[model samples]
Target: MLLSDQAGQTAATKIPRPATLRESVIEAIQELIVSGQLKPGQHLVESELAELLGVSRQPVREALQQLSGEGWVDLHPGQGAFVHVPTVEEADQLLAVRALLETESARLAALHAGEDGVRRLRALCARGIAAVESDDVEAAVATNSELHAVVTALSGNQVLAELASQVARRVRWYHTPVARRRGMDSWQEHTALIDAIEAGDEDRAAQIMREHTEHTRASYMEQRGSQPVEPAPKPVRRRRPRTSPTD
Candidate 1:
């Protein structure tokens, strides 16, 4: 009878484990950043974020530290955390890296992608175009990112997928603004890339991807202007004013 009671209790009483505070806080913060609710250079007040996430300051602090390590946040020594803003030079570097990685990914995808992969890529491109047509810049950016991610996954290389995902996160910083300006043309480029992939032309796919990334970098630079120029020093005043007073 004791054994029967023990079994009944074991079956009825489920173990209740609490969610990890750090993970919960991290996910909440990440979602806010990704959705553009917490923009670049925005101050991350620990107490405020903790309140919003329904978590303690400890978890929010740890999450911010982790995000800072991931290059998503900037942790000032005394001022606290803020979202990281990528400089024009940093954006250029990220685009270059993406061009290299994604070109190879596209090449591999072209060689390995079957009809199913092609269909998925087409659907992603269509979604991007529809988003742009609807004037949904954020949706367009998200769909575009998803398309590239799908291409990388089709490559069937886990390491490549990880690298592309990292690059894509950084690229998202530039993509949001660019998509707002570029609109449907961005999706048109996606169409060309997918067409190359569907044709099973590895070389063409790589070439197109490289050119697309370079064009995006150039457009971003053009939008932001060139590097900062130091202001010229003030010229010395003539002695005529003092001479007039003396005269």
Candidate 2:
């Protein structure tokens, strides 16, 4: 049955199944870390995290352990949990892999992207530019990820998309550091990339993606100090539990 609120419009159908508490906590903590609310090397305490997330300590503890396995958190024997501090070596290796994967994705996307796909790319690029102009680093970072995800999905190669997804969040983690510094130039490169894809210039699209990813890699390596970056002030976050349509 559909339900209506004060406006008297259709407000609901069958409500979606809720995420398990542990899953919700895991997603929340991962978001906090990725969005830099939880900084690298900062300690994570179960009770505090539970309070922050309005969940039980059990789920928070489970989330931390799960995150540690995913390399987003560190669980020391006696010192408790800390946000994982990725190293220069780790960044270089992961970003290199991402570059290789995305270059091919761009090439295939150019070869195969339909008119609708091109339109979608243009829309995402515009949003990304606006985010950069507004100096909303988090929004910019999220849009950047969405744009790339679309590129890969347009490739129409399930294997390639899966490969890209594996590294996507890690790539976002690395991109967060360089988003503001890359600024308009990065989005301009994306504009060129979208144009190439729309024109079905596979080689040009591939080359643009390769160079763009490399520029991001160089910016990251150049901007990073000998330690984890000091995160900017945490932006206010409002989030809902994640759901998979297939679930």
Candidate 3:
């Protein structure tokens, strides 16, 4: 009887874990992209990723599909998946859409966020600032993403929150490399935005949020080179005529 009870207890303790392989693959790939390891425009080979993660192709495929839906990866009809590299125009369009959604979310949050929501947002911002100060660009990006998510959630609109979250995830790709080079000042804009939110200044918060996202869009374009929407001009420098002393 004692032995059977002990066996039963051991069996109970050995309960099977939940299915997380697909989620793990998704997270690993996202980390690689955001940490600049995978890089923008890089191909995502399932075989290679499966080998690296010791996962089967099925889970990798599922994860890739999910990422593709999230706008993080581009799925080709027959060539397989590659990381999505937004053109300047695509970035501008995404930013414009996000600005409209997020500014309204911020406005709603300023009016509706409870004490707990405010605390969470402030904590996220603190973590983001710390990450920026320590030059941990990836962490800073993640924390900033979390801050926006919290604000959106506080709005209590499920549809808006879902849409904003998806848009923010895509925006994160552009900020990865840029954040490391830009450092804390890259996030300075958030300070005013958060301040306005905390003060319950809905209009100010909305305006600041819009401006912040627009600024990010502009910076991304500037970094890629001016006239980002247009094809780069061919290099043109006039050649100096040779000065020859003629008789």
Clash numbers, per candidate = 0, 0, 0
- Candidate 3 residues 1-247, lDDT tens each? 6867788566545677775989888988987876678866677889998998898999999999998997677777656788776677887788789889988998888888867878887788788889977877778888877877888898788999989877776678776646665566656767777777778889988888888777776777777784232322233566799999999
- The Cα RMSD of model 3 versus the native structure comes to 13.3
* C-alpha lDDT score of every prediction, in listed order: 0.82, 0.90, 0.78
Q: Which parts of model 1 have CA positions greater than 4 angstroms off?
A: 1-19, 226-247
lDDT digits (tens) for residues 141-174 of candidate 1: 8888899899899888889999888778668767
Per-residue lDDT of candidate 2, residues 1-247 (tens digit): 3333443664446678989899889888888887888878788889999899987899889888898899898887756888888888999999999999999999999989999999999999999999998999999999999999999999999999999999998898888878989999999999999999999999999999999999999999987864455532333455788987893
**lDDT of the structure predicted as candidate 3:** 0.78
Worst 10 residues of 2 by lDDT: 226-235
Please give the ranking of all candidate structures by TM-score, highest first, separated by commas.
2, 1, 3
Question: Per lDDT, what order, best first?
Answer: 2, 1, 3
TM-score of 1: 0.78
The better-scoring model by TM-score among 1 and 3 is 1
The TM-scores, one per candidate, come to 0.78, 0.84, 0.73
- Top model number, TM-score: 2
Error of 2 at 154 (Å): 0.5
